[model samples]
Target: MVLNLGGFKFEWKQTSEIAIETDFGINSQERIANFEALLSAKLGSQSINLNGQTLPFAQDGQEALKPLYALAELRQSLPLVTGLGKYLGRFAIEKISENRSVFAPNGAFFTQTFSLTLRRDYDADIA
Candidate 1:
């Protein structure tokens, strides 16, 4: 798979899902638990860079949510495709260091990792 990480600098990984160009956006499950999207993109390139390591979209909340850019998981947002099927959005979240939980706040405690998930309204797919 080819991914323009930031600039034209792309990343090629051993892809497991086939890129799907549907009537609206792209879709693929080779990367997410259930692959599907609205545009035409290599679905296998969805993930997050944590401590310089790429991690799955969902990590079972075992470790802290790091403040880094990650690939958007399709299944986490497919059901909410609205208005001409606009399913492409740069979904990301950084660790809320300032908002440290006093006691299990935002599902966190201490300097716990928290995800800046697709805004609450768009939480149907990427959460």
Candidate 2:
């Protein structure tokens, strides 16, 4: 597995990317960069996308994807305890896209392609 978020393991499949964005304020009079907005990086809003495919070996495609569905429905932030190398933070599911292809005799999916978009959840309570 490449990473485990909140307890759901992410196995190798396709590709993953992490994105970080920042905003800066400028002084019109000085014509130069002035100050950065509070939480300029938008830590809690930054998101990452994980793409993968699930194949039925001993279990159906729907069964293999149950965990992911559960996580997305929770609508809560979860801690990052393993993988993802040096980066450590909380995350919440922002979106989930799945494509099911190939079907079994009973109509269960044989293979499923999925993409998970997760938003960073900053631990700080900025009030």
Candidate 3:
């Protein structure tokens, strides 16, 4: 897995790419005023796609559906610890979007795809 959100894993097969974005939140005035100063900066938001597919070699489709289920059950009110390679931080799940896919007779899904939008939680007490 290339990334780990909370306790859910994002396998390389399921992920095409991982993108992390940072917004300095520096306005035009701030930039001009602090041109010679070492201004403070804030972390911005990030998003990722949690994609999975059931492989024929697998015994069941549960492995493909586990991350989807976990994301659906997550509480947006709380912040979750996330790690991507060596980067680690506390972030809140700002939004979640899922794409439709086929399912089996036993309710097992053939594929699971989700887009998660997260924002850094700056609160110091959010452990």
Output the number of the TM-score-best candidate. 2
Higher-ranked by TM-score: 2 or 3: 2
**Model 1 off-target regions past 4 Å?**
8-10, 24-127
Expressed as tens digits, the lDDT of each residue in 30-91 for candidate 1 is: 54766554546543334332221122323323242231223332222222222344444432
Local distance difference test, candidate 2: 0.65
C-alpha lDDT of candidate 1 relative to the true structure: 0.30
Clashing pairs in 2: none
Over the stretch 46-122, how does candidate 2's per-residue lDDT look in tens digits?
A: 56677777766543336777887898788887765445464456778888888888777988776777778777666
Summed over model 1, clashes come to 12
Candidate 3, pairs of clashing residues: none
* Tens-place lDDT digits, model 3, residues 28-106: 3335545654544544444433434334235434555556456647754333443445655665666666564677787
**What local distance difference test score does each model get?**
0.30, 0.65, 0.54
Model 2, residue 103: what's the lDDT?
76
* Candidate 2 Cα errors over 4 Å, as ranges: 13-44, 58-61, 81-87, 124-127
What TM-score does prediction 2 earn? 0.67
User: Candidates' TM-scores?
Assistant: 0.18, 0.67, 0.57
Scored by lDDT, model 3 comes in at 0.54
Error of 1 at 99 (Å): 24
